[model samples]
Target: MEQQKFEKMYLMQTVQKTIVILRAFTKEQPKLSLTELNKKTGIGLSSLQRFVATLVYEGFLIRDDRTKQYQLGLSLIHLGKLVEEESSIITIAQPILQQLNKATKESISMSIIDGNERRCIMNIESSYALSARNHVGDTSPLYAGASAKSLLAFLPQEEIDQYLDEVAMEHVTENTVVDREQLLEQLQEIRKQQYVFTRAERIIGACSFSTAIISNGRPVASIAIIIPEARFDEEQFDELRELILHAKFDIEKQLNK
Candidate 1:
């Protein structure tokens, strides 16, 4: 092949294979064996072996000797942030998120939309572990999760349609919504309340509350809290919702001026 064509070929394969490898890291299977990766990705064993080896060498994945699996590595984390937005939203939100966590005694997080997915941008962990599986940089579908749903409730209907068209609904738990009409109705209610709350929707035995951070006529991000079902009651939800709305107001106020 000519040099130009070879460069293009390499770029295309690199893009395709990189995504395939990255998609292997899920909340449940953050660690995976080469056999598991091959099974999950449907890639040929030899190709997967070569690619996995290269990824480990390049510092994108690491081998866990005790678990006999591979997980994301620090190199990826370092590179991921460097390539991400200039300055960190996490740094900006950390203080406020920590205050919210202290006030609610819940696991607080701030998430923003990133390429059709909602990415957790910051977190303030609770004394009790709440949604330990998700932290900064964790991605979730645009339709599910309280933070995502908070964004969805305020997002343009066209984007919502595009997301529904492009992504299939995955049943994270029994409470996850699949019916379009029902989801829309729920979204309407959330809009009316200016916040979202769900129980066992994205993760079993966990519930979340979220409010959108609207700026310049668009949802710029969301603030959410993860609370275990047993620890919080409806009255407690009311208090947290008020705090989230206040946080949204503060963010918007800062962005506007």
Candidate 2:
């Protein structure tokens, strides 16, 4: 009975309950009815109704007048726009990404390590049909991609060892380096060059290049570009490298203000 009261009290926290409701809708399930949301979230109908009422009032949620189906509202778009505008790095890098797209016609992406996973913060759509679009909230492994390696290279060896002990490399692909020695060697190269590049390391036909976005002598995040392995050329790297460096500097400069 005491545990039940404690759990119920904690569940009353608005932010915590909101996430439980909202996260139920994903790319596959983009909308849900009140009953469905309550079922999926396992919250009582009465309690869920009250929470939904608050969300609807706050404009974080909306209901269809005809069907009465509930979904995320325009307020989320407003909040997202505000986040994009307020983020120093994203604000500065947006135009730079545009300029890069014009110059290379390839997709560029930015990623940050969040605990044990990597989160893509910003990305530009690729013009080519063969190119892929990495979404902003997409999560990837910290040992799987060039951007992940760039982050690992910047972190201390002790930290890396501690992480490796838990993540025991399971091969995501035939090309992924599972051997600790080889991965350490790659990290060393990234540390020396301030960048990481891999051909078909994460995906069989895809290649990527990543660089650390450093501010105040520390890597705050990583920036990367993905290109088809068949399309990669050493000569093209020079132009892309310059553009990426400029973008990194612009983002860091915004931190000064």
Candidate 3:
């Protein structure tokens, strides 16, 4: 009886109970009625009503008045985008980026596909005097460079098709793939190899090696090393690929955690 009281008291934490209610919905079972939610969450009917009302009011949930079922709301997607933009990948990749800088002695960056473009959210420079010219906020077309290909390779099939159908490829350099058929083939190759190497594609005199960091079955960001064409060594290509892959794995692991 004493243990039962303690258990009941523990469940009284509003935040914990709210999270439990939210977690009751899954990918397999995205919508649930009030009775279903109560059964799954082990929340009593009265308390569940209060929590559901509050969550719905706050835009965390949407209720179907006709069916009396509830589903996740647009607010969660908005919150997820904010987290993607501000925290998870960037915060998790910082240490990995530092380590890559030390290992490669080349400029390293993390790029995310933002709409039809990719944004360089983080760039760590090598200790060496000369390196690639990339800043934290640099944005480039998703159809152009090694970093862009690494991201484009793992996007969903519909999104990829939409991209190919809509966007016009600009000829940034002679190496840039402005042809749709050729670029689609290249994207497939990148998906298979899990990396991309580009020579003066986006910028003249800059070569890049990149691989995507996939989380939850899709590419969230890409890890890349940029070097001047004069300094980029074919002999070091395999070594650099391995280094970027390791960093990608590290970031993905953190994201999963």
- Clashing residue pairs, backbone N/CA/C < 3 A, model 3: none
Q: How are the candidates ranked when ordered by lDDT, highest leading? A: 3, 1, 2
- Candidate 1 versus the native: TM-score? 0.65
- Please name the candidate that would achieve the greatest TM-score relative to the true structure: 3
lDDT of 1 by residue, 84-133 (tens): 53234445566777777778777888888888898987777787754432
Off by over 4 Å in 1: 1-92, 129-133
Stretches off by above 4 angstroms in model 2 are: 1-86
What is the alpha-carbon lDDT for the whole of candidate 2?
0.80
Candidate 3, residue 72: lDDT:
93
In angstroms, the error of model 2 at 221 is: 1.7
Cα error, residue 184 of model 1, in Å, equals 1.0
What's model 3's lDDT at 42?
Answer: 90
- As for candidate 1, its clashing pairs are none
